[model samples]
Structure formats: structure tokens, C-alpha cells
Target: MPLRAEGLGKTFRSARGAAVRALDGIDLSIAPGEFVSILGPSGCGKSTLLAILAGLDKATQGAAVVGGKPVTAPLVDAGVMFQRDLLLDWHTCEDNILMQFKMRGQPTAPHRDRARELLALVGMESAAQRYPRELSGGMRQRVAICRALVHEPPLLFLDEPFGALDALTRENLNTELAALTAHSGATVVFVTHGIDEAVFLGDRAVVMSARPGRIIADVRIDLPHPRGAHIRELPEFTAYTARLRKLLAHDGRPDHREGVRP
Candidate 1:
């Protein structure tokens, strides 16, 4: 499903009645099956913009629509994954994947096969019987990703899902996730600080300005798909990364915490 936003604005009142503008006049469009990664500084409204579109919050001005429907409340057609795995400590991985269906009051039998298949794709089939406590951080996140996609939602939102992992592990998950998102054919809005990860997974990268966030630049990734470690060594990869770095380093305040989540 396509996503469209127009003149979107969000404002929050401070403790002392000070109004803080988080997002202002943001216009964005994401086509079906396109993965767009959002990169920005901490105070920037990366998560806030997502919240409005995902129906986690309301927009102060303008409107956000998914598949032509206004996002005034939580939509069942969308799935969200956060930085934390949020897996249930007691439920088995299989149950965790089925949890979404159960919560939706939808039949679980129809999606059981898909749940198992997604687990195998991430090489976690053998661990399906294990609980979250029995798995490592990487394993837990793999399940989280599966849980998010189990229902086959057309629109997916992920906020720094791999931020807590080590570099090597994060890279591995990034590769797996890109492949999975492709296979599932979901239009994704992924917010991340890692420029390489952003470019690696997205069809396009959207860079946001500082506070009162608005898109500052949009860079298309013409690199090859099913991208591996070797792709990073290519000149195009370096050029894209360098361009994003230059954009983030503007105004004498280099966004050193680009990899840090808000």
C-alpha cells in the first residue's frame, strides 16, 4: 500500500507550557513495496513522524494516509517493530508469532505455516520451541522481525530495531531483514542512524533536519539488490555513504550520534 503525507505538523507543549514543534510541513510519499529509511539527529522527529503515520499518535496539522485511508487511529493493516524485542518471556517462539493473530481475533491456523517458514528463513526454526529467555539478543530480534511480518501487513514501521546489537550481528540482521522485507513485499518505513544500514536496506534514504524535523535530502540507492558485504566495497556504496555523511555533518554540528537512538 502507498503512503502519503501533506503539510504534516506535530507540536507538543513543554512542562512550563512551552510549545515545541517536533515536525513541521513535512511532505512525503512512499510507494508500495518500497523501503524508505529515515536518517536524522536524535532530537529530530524521526519517531514522531512514524507515530503519526502508524496511528500511534495524531497529527497536529495536515494528514497522513495509507492506501488512501486517513490514519486517525491504529490501523490493522500496519505492523511496527521497536528497538526492543518485546518478546514474551513465557511464550514459545511459535506462540509469539501467532500472538498477533490471537490479539486481532483472527484465526491462527491459517498463518501457522507462514510463522514456521519465517522462522526457518532466519535460521531460527530449531529454536521455535524455546522461550525468549532461552535465546540470545540476536535470536530474540529475529523472532521479533518474524512477529512483525507474520500477518502480512502491507505497511511496516521499524524504529532502530537493530540499534542494540553489535556491529557484526547488526549487519547480519540487516542483510536478513532486507531479504525478508523483499520476500514479503511490504512497504517499509525504517528509521535508523546508521547511514550504511539506511542505504543498504532502503530503495531511497530520507535525511531529516534537526529539531522541527523536515526532510532535508532524498537520495536514491541505485546499488544492486541482495546486497552483501562486497557491495560495501564498491565505489557507488562509498559515494552514497560519503554524500550522506557530508549532509549529516553540516552546520558545524556533525551528528556524531547518528547511530544513537533518541
Candidate 2:
């Protein structure tokens, strides 16, 4: 198995006695080296699902299995990135990237070299010695990408990693990230609210319904990879996005299926 979630569900108690259901019966299987994106509206449990998948939080209800084993806690094999790079302001970019190794308390010679290569991979090798304050927003995100890949994780979980950037910058990074994920052969589960971004980066965009979030649409992008910049200008891209929008516009919820206890 690459990463599989079976009957995943979560309910949290608020200040009041009532409970809020964040996710409901989310069953997803990401094949090894595939790129998949989770798309949903705000407060639709996209991040909550990502947290569960990343092993940062446990599902109140199901099981997550990775590489044929159950995911009981955070797994080092999957790297994670969020909206913010969250680099230490005082540390040089290279040092900040290397922090992943320090956190794991693992030996670093080979991984350190790999980190530098990752920096270069994102076109930030020259900024390796510079501090976060010295880099622009896009550059900081580039460093974040390098940091996420430094450990050479077989899987990557990204939660709105480009949500804060300007449109042009976000587009640029989207292209770069697609290329990098392809080059590295890492399976990716990305979360985003932007439909265009979902279409551009994901091999298939999985759309979730509002509130008690669950998969509502699984739209495949049939375009070839190493996708050229002009691919988005094609009619097929617009058609797929329009179809997803139409599906989401409908009010139906996912059918409850029987599975192992969550």
C-alpha cells in the first residue's frame, strides 16, 4: 500500500455540549507515486482530513495504513508542508531546511547533501546561506518545498501550500511543484480550495461536499504530464473544471457505506 484511509471520520466537542462532525466516511487510496488533490470549501474538513492522513491527528473513527502497515503516529516517510513555510527567521535557509533532520535525531551527512540538492532543485541553491528575512515570499515557499523534500519522503502531504501567494507566484510554484513531484516520484496528497490549482497540479482532483465533508467528485485530468504551460489554455481544462463545478453545485451527499469501525 502507498497510503490508504478506510472509513475515516472525526467528531470534536466544541465549547457547547454538541459535537461537530468534521469528516465522514472518507475512504481514499493513493497509489504509490501518484499526485492527488483534495478540493473543498473553507471549513469543509479539508485540513482535518489532511491532518489525519499526515498522522498529526488521529481519526476519531478509522484506520490509516501506509506501505502495508497501520499508521499509529506521525510517519517519517511522508513529508508535510502548510500555508506558511514557518522557517526560523534567524537561521540560514540551508540551516532551516536541515532542521528536519535535527527533529528526527537522525544522522545527516547523506541527508544534508540531499537537502542542498533539494534547495538546488527549487532554484534556491544560491540562497542557501541567506536568512528567511532575505528571501521574498515566493523564495521562502521554495525553501519550504526544499525542506519538505529534504528527508526524501516517499509521500508528501500539502495543505494549501500556496494559498497566501499572489496569483502569478502561485501559478509559477504550481508548475514547479508539479514538475518536482513528477521528477522525484513522490506520491502527493494536496489540499486546496482553488479549482484551477486543483486542475493544474493534480492527476485527479477529489472534491468534497460542504459541512460533513465527503468525496463528491473524483475528476481525472487526462492531460499528459510534464504538462506544458499552455495546457491550461486548452478547452479540455476548462471543460473538466466546469464539470466539477456543476457536480459540486448539486446538493447530494455521499452514500454511507459499511466498513471497519472508524
Top-lDDT structure, candidate number: 1
Residues 1-262, model 2: lDDT tens digits: 2888899998988998799998889898889988998887778898998888888988998877888787889887788999988989999998888888888887666677777888887788899889999889999999999888877789899999998899988888888888888888999999987778888888888988887888887877887778657878989989978877776666245445546477
Query: What's the residue-level lDDT of 151 in candidate 1?
Result: 91
Segments of candidate 1 deviating more than 4 angstroms: 251-262
Candidate 2 ranges with C-alpha deviation above 4 Å: 251-262
Q: Tens digit of lDDT per residue, candidate 1, span 5-52?
A: 889999998899999999988999999999999999998898999999
lDDT accuracy of residue 235 in candidate 1? 94
Q: Indicate which candidate wins on TM-score.
A: 1
Cα displacement (angstroms), candidate 2, residue 98, comes to 1.1
> What TM value does model 2 have?
0.91
lDDT of each: 0.90, 0.85
TM-score, predicted candidate 1 vs. hidden true structure: 0.93
Spell out the clash pairs found in candidate 2: 61-262, 62-262
Clashes of each: 0, 2
